[model samples]
Target: MAEFLGYENFLVAADGAVRTVRPEHLRVLPGLGEHDGEPGSCDGLTLEGVVVDVAFRGVDRVVTVDADDATGTTVRLTADVRDSALTASPGDRILLRADAAHVVALAG
Candidate 1:
């Protein structure tokens, strides 16, 4: 079942619960593995997946990532990134990291 842990930082279960995370909260990085000294490390959450789509939205590019959650269920996450900061293309494997403090669990 999906778990809820109030507002702010919360555990997202595999049971399908609405998450209140902003696209800006997601940080995209090249390659995989634990990002220890890297900014926005996995100390919060780390998602590895292939870039499915990239859409230009003004100065920011919306990157769509297809990844699996903790339960192994495929999930789609979008991250808003600046054009100068984006270096990913379709089929490129990337990592998405977000501080738990920016994640919120809503009752479903």
Candidate 2:
């Protein structure tokens, strides 16, 4: 079985020794916000990326992004945002924010 550790920004897995933050824990917003290149005052984990895909699902909008991680490697992520809240299209740059409170630990 895998052991897990939960933290404010991410989750730690025992055997794999990896940290992860799920899509549900992230918020996709248009990069045009006041905090363009940086995290907003209330953000816990912030990431800037280019929109790779966007799909409408009823009241939600599913967005996929290709963001550079701390090591400059591209990381692909998907998140669901309110349809009305996302104004970005494919090829647009956007911001992803995850609040500490929403972060959780999961078994690998």
Candidate 3:
């Protein structure tokens, strides 16, 4: 079982259904405001979404995803070496860390 440490109260079922496991769920992370700081750091939050686009560079990979949250924010993810080669396509469900900073997509 992969435990989302920072999001102990936020759980998503295997069928993509989201539910609040606890009443204080939303208060787990309080520093993720839109303008509080930079993006890309998952220190205080976790995000789940579907991959909307993907591009690969020499040894780097970039992914564009639309989060399932109400903000409807589009986030770009930089893949680690292993993740960079994973077979990801549009609409593939994924779980990512919030506060992601560098949202740059790789050039095709």
Candidate 4:
């Protein structure tokens, strides 16, 4: 069984391809905040990408996206819904923004 690592509060799903967790889970390491001269500010860093995969775990929906940046990174975002209709699907283009605390994807 795959060992679930520590939970990430923020993420973005890419391309709807399940099992590909590559670039989605990358996070800025601690002590690299804006006060320390990081390029992007600690809060409100933005990324644009194409939706790759979408998954559901209990009440939270996980999405994976292939980013269109130099890093070519993939991201995952989580959404909690009162009902299942809120779930995202494959082939969706999305924009995501996040602060130091959490990542928020703007549904397109």
Question: Which candidate wins on lDDT?
Answer: 1
Candidate 1 on 6-101: residue-level lDDT in tens? 222233455566555667888888777646578655456777889999999888998888887777768777888885956899999988888878
| Decoy 4 TM-score against native | 0.42
Q: Against the correct fold, how does model 2 do in TM-score?
A: 0.67
| Candidate 2 per-residue C-alpha lDDT over 25-102 given as tens digits, one digit per residue, 9 for 90 to 100 | 678777656565554426355778899998888878778888765656677878877758558899998887777565
What local lDDT does model 4 show for residue 19? 28
What C-alpha lDDT values do all the predictions have? Answer: 0.74, 0.66, 0.42, 0.43
Off by over 4 Å in 1: 1-18
Clashing pairs in 3: 39-99, 39-100, 39-101, 40-99, 40-100, 40-101, 41-99
| CA deviation > 4 Å runs, candidate 3 | 1-43, 69-85, 98-108
TM-score for candidate 3, please give it. 0.39
Candidate numbers, best lDDT first, in rank order:
1, 2, 4, 3
In the range 32-93, model 4's lDDT, one tens digit per residue, is: 12234544534544555555776667665566555543344444433332345534457755
Candidate ranking under TM-score, highest first, comes to 1, 2, 4, 3
Global CA lDDT computed for model 4: 0.43
Better of 3 and 4 by lDDT: 4
Tens-digit lDDT string for candidate 3 (1-108): 213432233333333444332212211121224433445454534665667776665665555555544344343333332343366677777655433232222222
Q: Single out the weakest 10-residue window by summed lDDT for candidate 4.
A: 25-34
Q: How high is the lDDT of residue 22 in model 3?
A: 21
Cα-based RMSD of the predictions, in order? 5.5, 6.0, 16.3, 12.1
Collision count for each candidate, in order: 0, 0, 7, 23
